[model samples]
Structures are given as structure tokens and as C-alpha cells.
Target: MVSKVKIKINDLYKIFGPKGESHVEKVKSGMGKPELLEKHSHVLGLQNINLDIIEGKIQVIMGLSGSGKSTLIRHINRLIEPTAGQIFIDDTDVLAMSDEELMNFRRFKASMVFQKFALLPHRTVLANTIYGLTMQGLEVKEAEERAAHWLKRVGLEGFEDRYPAQLSGGMQQRVGLARALATDADILLMDEAFSALDPLIRSDMQEILLELQEELHKTIVFITHDLDEALRIGDDIAILRDGRLVQQGSSQDIVLNPADDYVGDFIKDINRARVLTLGTLPLKKASTKGIALSNNTSLENAMKALVDAKKDSVIVVKGDKKLGSVSMHDIVHAATRSSETAGEAVTYR
Candidate 1:
């Protein structure tokens, strides 16, 4: 009963007009709802989006390009205004904030990391990390100490004197990560911060980010199109499609129980073995016995075990006692379910 909502995005919407300059006098005058207008003629850039990213949680906002993922992330920090809705960060109404309040919020409450690692190319790493503190008018010595601390935390300890152009993609992103962390903000809005790198570098960045999240526990609202990356970093995931929130839940739920055809199609080719758990697929309890497996193992993986064991089924165990089992038949049954088929997924704990 004590868990509180941290970041709440309530029924948000944003629209775009087909014409250049994107005029909407009716919306400005508060005479027309964006929904009705967009349905008939306007382009709905974002539609009735609702999300709650809890404090100290890593929530990934994932979708294909044009899925409104980026648009939704922008609303939290007022980088882009919503057409309608209320966004509250720590119960503070974001839209109602004055210029001073907004500035203070951005200065002390939220930090954003971009795909391009938006660093001042001319500035040294230490200088860039301290930029936000300088803007707040902190003493130069104090800011430098704080920046140095964060630089060390991000594994850029000796690179304080290096410029952005002197760093590699991963190294530059480390600087970006350092800058964001130096702000000591409670929330980090990352919009494809690692998407620009090669796969190897992206994996390294992901590990670095995971370590950072573990150390910082900042409520991160991340936007990404890569499914593996989403599964890697997200504690909860909200999927968007064509501006609407298609589904929101743990990554397990989305993979095992997709909300719609569109979502199913998206996950159709994913290696369910890597993404699912033994708890996701059910095993018929027999009249006699079963073999146990760690709750962490997936059915696709469990199937391999079943084959290797040459047994009728295998049990799911937490530590000692058996929780459940999966037979070869059960393995085939779960695996054979057409990724495109319309049916409810069976999950047993």
C-alpha cells in the first residue's frame, strides 16, 4: 500500500497538421479536441497515451520507427508540449509549472541523453560534465569535484582532459553518461542513446548503462526500437504503435502474451527461448513425479533439457522443491502455437 506513483502520463495527445507551419487555431483556442480533429483530418502524432514509470524502475518505451516512442519521452520533460493530458513527476503537475519551476525541474530533477551524445565538441570531458552545475552557478571548484566523481563512476577517470572528438563512440557516450549522471537528477530520459553505435559497442554501452542504473537507481524512461535492448534493460515496458499505447507490462508479458496481432507480428521471430521463462509455460501435474528447473529457465530452453534428460517432463524449482514440470508434448504444444495465432497464452507459476 505504500508504493507511490512516480511518473504518471495521463491520457496524453499530440497532433500534427499535414500543412507546413502546423497551424491549429482551434486547438490553441481550446475549441477542438485533438482526437476528433485528427481522426477526420489531422495527423495524430500521439494519441491518448497513458503510462506510469515507477520511481527507481527502468521502463522502456519500445516500438518501430514512427511509433510515437520519441514523442512520448519528450512530454515528460516538456521538451515537447502535449496536446492534452497531465504529466506528474513526483506528484508535481508538470504542465502547470512556471518558467522558473520548469527550469528548476530540468536543472535538478531530470536529465536527458540523446542518440547523438549531444556533447560540446569543443569542451573537455570534465568541462562538459560540469556544464549543468555551472549553469546553476555552483563554485567552479565544487563543480569540478562533482564532475570528476561522476567521470570516475562512468569509467572515464583519466579522460577528463580529452575532447569529444578525441573519444570513440563508446567513450563519447561514456562522457554523455557522465554528464547526465553528474546532474544528480532523479530521472533520466534516454532516447536511443546507444542506437547509433555498432552492435559490439552497443552491447558494451548497455552493460555500462545497466551498471549505472544499478548504482544510481534513477527512474529511467528509455526509448528504443531494438527488442533485445528493451528486454536487456527494461523492468517494465510500454509498447507504442501509431501513437497509441498498445500494451504495457513486464517484458515477459509482452513476449508471452502479446495484446494484438500487430504486437504478435512484432515478436513472431524473436527467440522465445531467450525471452521467456519456465513460469510462462504450463506442465500438467502427473499422478506420480517431476524434475525441477530454476524458475529463471525458459520453456524453449527447458525443452532442450527435456530432450537431453530423455524423460517425460522436467520440474521447475526455485531452490529445492519442485514447482512444475514440462513434458515433451508440453514443449511442442507451447512452441507450436503459431506466433500469428489468436489465443490466450497459458502461464503457470
Candidate 2:
């Protein structure tokens, strides 16, 4: 049977240090849990990570440098085996695959783009795009034709002959993206692939990734430290800290109902208007004689209704049917409570 969840991680652990040692020790020390892990020296790259990457949606694993975002993505593709825990891709335990099985899994199922572009410095863009398929024994002509297709798909229609050294950083990254696409894998793993590009190009790349997803519906696991990027590109987000998952939820849910303080602080300054929607707010009975807002409208937009409708209440409508109303007081309350709840979740982490 096809799996409902494209990726599943449960009680996952990755420790760095001596072989057979726990990494949580190092994790504790760094997080000021030092004397706490006094019994061991291993560093916990990931701790009891429990998450589900829904099929065909961009799931951004977000955190700072040491938060283990990269380590986590690598786990999904089995680039680095988890020290302990279970990782499943389409119902198969990735960690249980033999060497050949793993190789086949990677070639046919997972494709990745990296931060450094990972293009052959000496090869032309077209050659680099076809490199992976060529390794799998595809004929030169077939691979070239496929490469040309992705080149056009990624808007690099005419730059196939240029070498990586000859292209702008943005263009080089596109070549890498095209190469990954050419592999025709079921999943795409991107590790800060746009961080090296200038802001303007990064924004363009973000749009490109979204459009690609719309057409292919390939499951995507993207890593990023930028909150804005996470909010913009992720269908769901899994926030990590101290090498452990802090929280996971839809972008709107995370912004509207943060699981902890670390997440709240991470998103505190975010313009709510850009991150929250009516779905984030609580709905009340409508026919009680009060103003209302569309269920699809954002809380920020609903706030406008509360203000412009000149009433402390607004109705919530689902299509033509009246769902409920949110009073001005509830609006302010939800807003503040959500932030505080996030702050509280931070304490847990």
C-alpha cells in the first residue's frame, strides 16, 4: 500500500563523539545541561525526534546552525544513519535497507540539492544535470534529452553549455536544482540551497521551488534558518533546537498557536498579517446578531473587520453559511495568548 506519510521519524537519536557513546552528554553541556550529562560525553545531534512529513508538501526543518536541521534531513535520506530511532520512507525502514537496497532507494527515490551548489566545477551545466542519470547507466542521448527538459523547467533554457565557474551563484544553484529534478526521485531534500544566493535571487528560487511542487507534488524536506523562508515555502514546519524537535505544525498553526517560547521568540517580530489566518482564530456562533469574517480570511484581515465594522464582534462565515463571530476582545485575546503559549513551549525545550 502507498504510505500516507512520506517520512516518519520516531524517537530518533544521533550522537557525535566516540563510537557507542551517547551524544546527549555534549548536548546538555552546550545547553547548560553540563553537569547534567556528566556521566557521558556524546553530543546529541537529535533527541527523541518524532515527526511526520506529509506526502507531497514542503516540510521545512528549521533552526540555527547547531540545532541539527541538517542532521535531521540527512536522516530522512539515510545519508547518516540515526544513532537510534526509526526512520521510514514510504513504509520501509530506511535504516534496515542493505547497501544495495539503500543505493537503489537513493537513486530511484531521493534526490537532493545542497548549499554549495555541488556542481562539477569543470562540467558544463548540461553535463552536470545529466551526471546522476549517466551514473545509473542511462545512455548519453537519453540523459541529455532529460537534462534539457529540466533546464527548461527551471527557467535555465539557454545556459546548458556554461560551466559552473562561468555562471552566477544563482544560476549555479539552478543547475543543481535541475540535476536533482532530472533524477526523477519521489522526494527532494534541500539543505539551505538558497542561502548562498542574493536576496532577490533567493526570493525567485523560493517561487521556483513552490511552482515545481505544484506541478510534481513530490514530497519535499527543506532545511533553513530563515524564518521568512520557512513561513513562505513550508506547507508544514518542524522546528528544532538543541538538537531536538521543539514543535511541528502547519505554518499558520505555528504562527497562530505556537507550541513554546523558543518558537514564539523565533517568530515574535513576524508581521502577523502575513502569517495568520481566520482558521487560526476561535469561531463563535454567528446568528447571535454580530459582525462576521470569512473563514478563509486571516486574523489580521479579520482584525480589520472588527475595526472597520465598528463593532467589538465579527461573524465567521464558511461559504454562504454563517459559522461564528469573534469579538474584538477575543481577537486581542487570541493574539496575545498565542504568543504567550509559544513562549511557554520554549520553556519545555
Residue-by-residue lDDT tens digits, candidate 2, 1-349? 4747989888787876576345443443454333324556555677778999889889999998888999989988788877778998888999999999988888879999999998898889999999878867799999999999999999999998988999999989999999999999989999999999999999999999999888999999999989999999999899998877888888887786677677878887677765776656767666566665677776677777677877777777777887777777776666555355443434334
Off by over 4 Å in 2: 1-3, 21-40, 284-293, 299-315, 326-349
Q: Can you tell me which runs of candidate 1 are displaced by over 4 Å?
A: 17-42, 286-291, 300-312, 318-321, 332-338, 341-349
Residue range 267-291, candidate 1, lDDT tens digits: 7767677778877777455334455
Instruction: Please list the Cα RMSD from the true structure of every candidate, rounded to 1 decimal place.
Output: 5.5, 4.1
Taking all chains together, each candidate's TM-score versus the true structure is 0.85, 0.85
C-alpha displacement of 109 in model 2, angstroms? 0.4
